[model samples]
Target: MTPTVIPIDTPGLGDRTYLAHDGAVALVVDPQRDFDRVLAAADEAGVRITHVFETHIHNDYVTGGLALAEAVGAQYLVNADDPVAFERTPVRDGDVVPVGDHMRVRVVHTPGHTHTHLSFALSADGEPVAVFTGGSLLFGSTGRPDLLGPDHTDALVHAQWHSAQRLAQELPDTTEVFPTHGFGSFCSATQSEASASTIGDEKRSNPALTQDEEAYVAELLAGLEEFPAYYAQMGPANSAGPGAPDLSDPELADPAELRRRIDAGEWVVDLRTRSAFAAGHLAGSVNFGIDGQFITYLGWILPYDATVTLLGETPEQVAQAQRDMVRIGMDPAAMATGKPEEWADGAPLGSFPVTDFAGLAQELRENPDAERVVLDVRRPAEFDSGHIAGAVNVPVHAVLAHLESIPHQQLWVHCAGGYRASVVASILAARGHDVVAIDDSYDESAGAAGLELV
Candidate 1:
């Protein structure tokens, strides 16, 4: 009588949504805004989705519980404490929600990530089998308690301590743990490579479990880096019960309109390889390349409501790009495919000049008098641990708002490799700055780049 669990990963957000079924009926937990995947899972399992659960008002990404439940004619269950604008089944602590004839989930009030969060413990044929921990207790780490802002951070941290310990004390050690965050995702206080775990494994391996309440809270708070600014929009959107937008292929733009968007100062986002974009692109077009963390950077900088013109190499690439955008609640205005030269139409093409580590060293030696800034776009932790001498540290996520860090002269940018460096180079180039992107391996040429490792 074991329930089937279909774990779906959203690689961009480092999150997972699950469809748990008892063969005849199914339930979804913390689904992303896009419903097609979850719907497909239900269809493949040959079960009707009868219930959708939201652990809390999600701050990282919009949960599709409301809209998805509506789409499939299922009941959307939310915490009674959350004053969502729409109608939903109000769930309270210790409530046993029956999924089908053989399986039921007992709601546990595990409020740490948010004040109203609830984790569900699944029971199959009256035996505890697994638990949907949501943001409560992740596999190797716990959810960051600071999403509620400064005033509530300490309180949430304290709550997080008790809630985590409570989960361990209440649930059996053998119960499987399925969490919604911390899969190379920024939502966790720290990162873990684990995809799934059992309660017994978590008790021994999770860092928070080893420390006292005060020590755990302090450690968790100190490890948090800047989260995406677009997070502010997610909670409101999810609470309003977002409707499923048409993720169909956008209208293809002719060269005439592509030129106009460039003239009008709208973002013409180019989705290609970093190497490809570095070679050549339409002047005024910026590259947040499709092959790397495209969606994360899209949310990091682009105005949430802005309609961007998309440029990709092929129709298939553009279509794949659209799904990446729609999953994060972004919709592009138009899409086009072709060479930069074709779209440029007699206008000057823009390109980022890539310098290998050795060549970059030679340039600095030759022109020590030249005014230039070596900008490192890695995280603060990476920069603090070790970095090249005189390279200004500005994480790619925070670069858009912190343009004043630009040194007012020539700019040379490098990340650990070249993917993030390409993103920064594109942003600076769009603003009419002279930017050089380093395309070589940072690890191999630490000596060449004159890195200062501690």
Candidate 2:
């Protein structure tokens, strides 16, 4: 019988955790720090978790393999050569481990995304079923190789090319490919539109399979962009073995206390809709809205050692943000729930005007002589492709450090969509800048607005 594969998606971080079972027993692959989800899946499937596997010491998020294994009393399998601090059942290339009655997993050292990366090929009753390619061969692309710093990047990319080829040549074309990255994860060398694929599909579409190694390497390296700054902390946390996240209700902060934290330079984040945040929020509380790429940007921009106090509209919203926080080994120092008014007590809330690309276009047309600053907060590549003429380019991630570069005039901020622009606008608004967030799609609205695009 073929094992059932259940993919637990963490879309905020663009990663997936797999729970595969063959009737009575289950095996988990590349689980996030929240392992309770894996336990729940196993319980629902009526199977016992007997093994946990790690693809590599992940550079994206803290792994739950060690915690999950210890919780379920399962054998935790990690690369034998990994310099990890915790005890695990060391696995190496060519090792085949039987799982219950129908499944057998063969470990293949794929070594591209990381030096000791391994992909597990699963089979049932001697027939190939699937391969879990974590941070190695992706659905239509390959995992990026530069996360190990610049020195190892060259060697890793070459290894990644060979690893993808080996999987393509060795695995049967019919075998299903379940990769942990490539679902909008920065870990992918490039993004793919495919949700699911087979080795046959990848062989035709994956660059590593179709292009010469040098060509693939050149393209992949050139395409690499900035990843989350939080990633620098992930590898060490995973190597040290992460524990299960604390999802208990955080200590509630009073209005005065919230003000104190903000004054003390602690990150008091507002997790609301960009519009809701723009309309009104506590002064000095920056927005990383729950409705958008909240975790990714928050993890990227937040200082490594900064104390974070989350403010959400409801207990559920704060709980969700807290779960996201722990994946990166961060925990909210405190929380404040309900409306911004309640959090502010009687203090006047801070706010800024929000507009669309059309509004911006009209503003430019009406006041051609006005010294208005149109800030494009998208990546440099995005700005280079096509951007508003005369707009200042400052990627949202770097805005905090490059504030001086921005003029102290009326500022209009926009990103590919409105999410990132809202983040930057909130930050600038809190710093006493007259900012307007353009809360609209850049593609659908920018060109239509008749603004000059360079």
Candidate 3:
């Protein structure tokens, strides 16, 4: 029987899910909270999942192993050292789990990314065939040591270095190496273009393993980017085993119902297109459209405790909106019931109109006479490559934590596109500051406008 690997891409979060085995049993690795694609794939393949495994307690995205277990009556597995509050079958080093007549998975404790990280070695006919090195060893880069904290940098790097060397020495040269995270994942310092690689290739090319432990640790720490504040809340939520979310079909409510919920202090999150949202959204609804970095912005601006009512352009849009919310550690209870049009009754949510290129040019001219605070909400590297003149660089994810440093008056915000600027606008508005989101067109014209970067 040929083993199959399913790549589950949960937009705004990352990739997960593994469907291994010839045909009878499935082993899912790190099925995150937003696993619509994984569920759909499993249903299409007609496979009965037997085991769900989480390599570790994920800090960036909520894990779906518990939910998948509940849905399919599968046993949830994790390393024996995990401090998670769930009843999981603890699999330790050298433990073999029988998959079917001719296959078995050998658990290997490869704890480097976190204190409880695990990897699995797949075997057929008593010979190792593949290895699932969740975060311990990626295709190009190893997992970031900073996840554990600055204090654990040395220990974590040493642990990862030793773990990779162990795998390189123990696993066969021909064994395939599949990692949980790939390119675009914030978890690793340098993710590979491809999702999977062979053990021999990684040993030859991975920089993390080739460098000394101290130098590797220093390089990893220095290259670390600021993660979302919401990341801290995800680890516990994933470990606790999420309760059944309200998966009921959305009921269409009248405008009065939408207005009533809004009045009752529920946050109306408009998941429409930014242009459409700018054209019109429910009075006072926060506009974070479906197209952009919806989950990242959602985590950045929305309060952890706030109840959110989603306004989507289509039925599928609403479902995606709900799924994205769960990915970022927001409880399903926070999701508001009903369709977009139905809930959009009463006065509009307070609108912070976007400024076009021409409007932005005018604002810059006018602000020069006053205390101008131009906020650049891009990543640090992006900020370094040239940014708007006289702009303070505070990444959108780090903005809330560093808000005290931002001047409270007359702040203008812009990102690579308009999406992040809108997110920044919402955050500043909540803080009672006067701010405006510059349209994407303005960012395109920044060079023409003679914006200088320091």
Candidate 4:
């Protein structure tokens, strides 16, 4: 019988958790941040996950391999060449990892996306079946060569070329290829809408494999998009285990006790949705919505030096928030207890006033020449679709470091919805900027307010 393969999607972020099962034992691959959902899926499956493998040092989000390993008592594995500071069993090329009586995985070192990228070949009952390509090769395109150093682009191109050829020549043509990242991920230069591909199909259809090494290098080097400025900082955080919290936890603390903890230097993170957060939030708490790429934003705004206590509505939300923090190397001493309203003595972080189209129109009209800077904190694609006329694009993930460039005048920010805008508003407020967060409806009111986009 064929072994079962189960894929679990992490909510908000697009990372995946895979389980390759052979009756009693299972292997999990690339369990990055946003792990609560992944954990639940594994529990439901009732398979004993014995090994956790990381494809590479992740840049876009935190890795959940450590936490998952700890939770399930599994051995964590990464490429032998990786410089991860955490303890992990080093896997190298051709080493077989047994999953059960009839299933095994062979690690193949395929470095190009990073200095330490790995792919795994699966064999069931002594027959080769699939390869977990990780970031080395995707459905439509190869992993970006620019992730390493620009100086090593040529070498990386050659490595990747040889790597693809090796897999194509060595692994059976029938082998299914599963990659860690897909479309919308920053890791790959090009990705298909479809998630998985077969080795035979990739050999015939992948553009990167058809080009000569030099040509491939040239194509990859030309005009790669600027990565989020926050990406550079994330690698190091992942390297060092989450450091000591800059603040104390208040999860068990009552309203007064929570305030005392904050007074003693703990920072509160409001993880509610933007609409819920905007309607009412703790006055000084930064509003990073719990949904949709929350960990990436958390890494961007939450200072490594601060202790972070979460303000979440549900238990699952709270666990997710905690796991996200841990994945990115932010170990909070403790979380705050009770609801936002309960923390009476804690000072308000800042007001994230949720505005409808009309409210934004009135605000824009009232502040005609007051140096009001309208910041559109959406992705490049979203910004292209009709934004507030004159709004400068500074994606929320890249906002904190570039704050010096933002004029110190009054700032108005909006995202597709109120969520990201609130996160940006809180970030600016923390930096002492006067900011007003507008909901997605800002664009609808822009025409009525007579605001024009350039």
Q: Please state every model's RMSD to the true fold in angstroms.
A: 1.7, 0.9, 3.5, 4.6
Question: 168-219, model 1: which lDDT tens digit per residue?
Answer: 9988999999999988677788878876798888899886677888898888
Model 1 quality (TM-score): 0.96
lDDT of 4 at 297: 65
**How much lDDT does each candidate structure score?**
0.86, 0.93, 0.73, 0.72
lDDT of 3 by residue, 7-90 (tens): 776547555557675576677888876555566777788777888877888877777788778888888888777777878898
**Residue by residue across 294-371, what tens digits does model 2's lDDT show?**
888998887877799999998889999999989888999999999999999999999999999999999998999997
| Candidates 1 and 4, the one with greater lDDT | 1
Sorting all predicted structures by TM-score, with the top scorer first, yields 2, 1, 3, 4
Off by over 4 Å in 2: none
Name the weakest run of 10 consecutive residues (lDDT summed) in model 4: 241-250
- Per-model TM values vs. the true structure: 0.96, 0.99, 0.86, 0.78
> Least accurate stretch of 10 residues (summed lDDT) in model 2?
297-306
lDDT (Cα) of model 1: 0.86
